[model samples]
Target: MAKIVVLGAGLGGVIAAFEIRKSVRPEDDVTVINENAFYQFVPSNPWVLVGWRDREDIIVDLIKPMKKRHIELVVGKAERVEPDQKRVRLTDGREIGYDYLVIATGPELAFNEIEGLGPKGFTQSVCHIDHAVQAHTAFEAFCQDPGPVIVGAVQGASCFGPAYETLMIIETELRRRRIRDRVPMTYVTSEPYIGHLGLDGVGDTKSLLESELRERHIKWITNARVIRAAPGMMTVEELAEDGSVKQLHELPMKFSMMLPAFRGVDAVRDIEGLSNPRGFILTDKHQRNPKFPEIFGIGVCIAIPPIGKTPVPVGVPKTGFMIESMVTATAENLGQILRGEAPSHEATWNAICLADFGDKGVAFVAQPQIPPRNVNWSGSGGWVHTAKVGFEKYFIGKVKAGKSETFYENAVLGLIKTKKIKAH
Candidate 1:
């Protein structure tokens, strides 16, 4: 009997455990290890910050789902990974062994890399559900006395969609409150351009986003490195194409939400040959670690190199579609291994994103998730906001039902049909 373990219970981990449970034989054991007992829909975090969603609205108690699926849940913090021993050491003096392991522990937010940044400091964040709640509190206070607002991602940050979503969402809220004019908003990003999105401009995102910001009277600074974040003030250094300091700007802001860079979690990071220098898991096409074939990795914790050299470091985003592909591929490959057959599945790594503003949003698809793709498409309208709302419900329901349906694939089919109409 194979003992399969999935570490972390985020989007990738939860879905991986469910999918693998379906794929494996009845006698094969499946278990999930997560630091949290509940699952929060991360994509809804921006809405939470704007008071559109409460904590309970997005959270699902994992206990019920795991029990229903018959998948064991080990709710505890992991201290370290002993790859050689094929075991995981818990913080509370316990070791869990596994025949095959899937590591989906998402990125460790690198907020400390900047001075006076993150929730513990001056700025707010929507990376986690708790952070989103705190950001909502700060948003309410900022609305009372509106001033300049800064929203964007810092250097080495991979996930750019949330930053953009939060930026536009905040703008939409400020306008709804009729205090938009009282607050000057600026988008500061490490991307070379307004809509680079760490994928080098999917379709016409540069034009789409730039036009949106202009229409909303929002300012922007690309290739920006936020050096420090003091209360009501931000120190930013704009970088030249040659990576030199071009200009230093002291941007004033009463409220801010800056997306920090991501690195692998402490448990698996520093494991010899398991993680890269930046602590992201090293995996091949099958999402299987080359040095340790029994271990697979998916989602934000996996290492995906930047598309190309940029003025400032901008890591590639592992979008929902891409992570789903990884989970499917990993499950298929593990099933093959359990059956005494060689694994052959490989994730497509496609990128499909829905970046919703309050009333409108943008949707983009990158076939291969890299540059020079077959189906590089992006579109925007009020429909995207509706679509995103549907997506949030669909995904959270899947978590409750223990289903790993190809959510993005199904959504993208309709998007492609729409793209075809536009093409004609």
Candidate 2:
């Protein structure tokens, strides 16, 4: 019997385990290794920072769900992945061998790359649950004494939605507290434009997001490179098209949250032919590592080159639907291999997002995530905020149920898609 191991229990890992269980042979052993015992809905982090969500609201204890599904849960931080040995070594000196391994460890936040960036430094971060909690405390303190606020993604950062989400959500909250006028906000991003979003601005995101920023009286600095972030001050350099510094600005702020660059986690990085220079797993379209077919990768941990050239480096975002597609494809391919058949499944890799602005939001879907494609669409309204909240509930429920989206739920998603298009 093949011992299948799934590493990391984030969005990609958890669903992968549940779906793999159904696809693989009954006798095949399915185990999951994660650094934490509970799963935090990362998309809801911005809401948490404003006290809209408690730690318990989005955190799902995986022990119960994994047990219910009969999937072994190994709770430990992975030290390294010995691909040659087909085993993963944990920090506690324990090791787990496997016939097949799915690496979904996600990216390691590269806060140290920039001077005085991150929760430990001058800026706050919402990349993790704990970080969001800390950021909330900072937010509360800032609200009591409002001043200039800096919120955006730094250079080389992949995920840009949360940067925008956190920016607007905090803006919405500050207004709610009647302290908005007392605070000046600036959005500093590596993207060439306000809505570039790494995919080069899906549909009319450029116009929509720009218009929204204008209506809300929020100033933005695209192609911004954060050189240093000292307490209550950030040194920002705006880049020209030729990659030269056009201007430098010292922005004063009482609160800041800059999304840091991301690299591959320590566990699966730096092996010969196993990963790229950045430590991201090198995988074929099938989501299987070329050097080690038994080793598959999904989510932000996988290597995807930047979409196009920009003044500053901006990595592509692996959105929820895109990662979900990767998970489904990998599981199906693994099932084929186990059944002694050639795999013939490919993920759609559609990029979809619901960028919530607290009370209202923007929603978009890119057919293939990579540009110049069909079905590039985006829209905005209060409906998106409601949709995002509904999705949070639905997804967490699925995780608790130890299942993927059910057939009925899938139909509901289809209906939602129809409604979104109509609203658009």
Best by lDDT: 1
TM-score, each model?
A: 0.98, 0.97
RMSD each, Å: 1.3, 1.8
Tens-digit lDDT track for model 1 on 72-130?
99999989989999999999998999999999999999999999989999999999999
Lowest summed lDDT window (length 10), candidate 1: 415-424
Runs in model 1 lying further than 4 Å from the true structure: 418-424
The CA-based lDDT of model 2 is what?
0.91
lDDT of 2 by residue, 165-201 (tens): 9999999998899989999999999999989999999
Query: Which 10 consecutive positions of candidate 2 have the poorest summed lDDT?
Result: 406-415
Off by over 4 Å in 2: 406-419, 422-424
How displaced is residue 74 in candidate 2, in Å?
Answer: 0.4
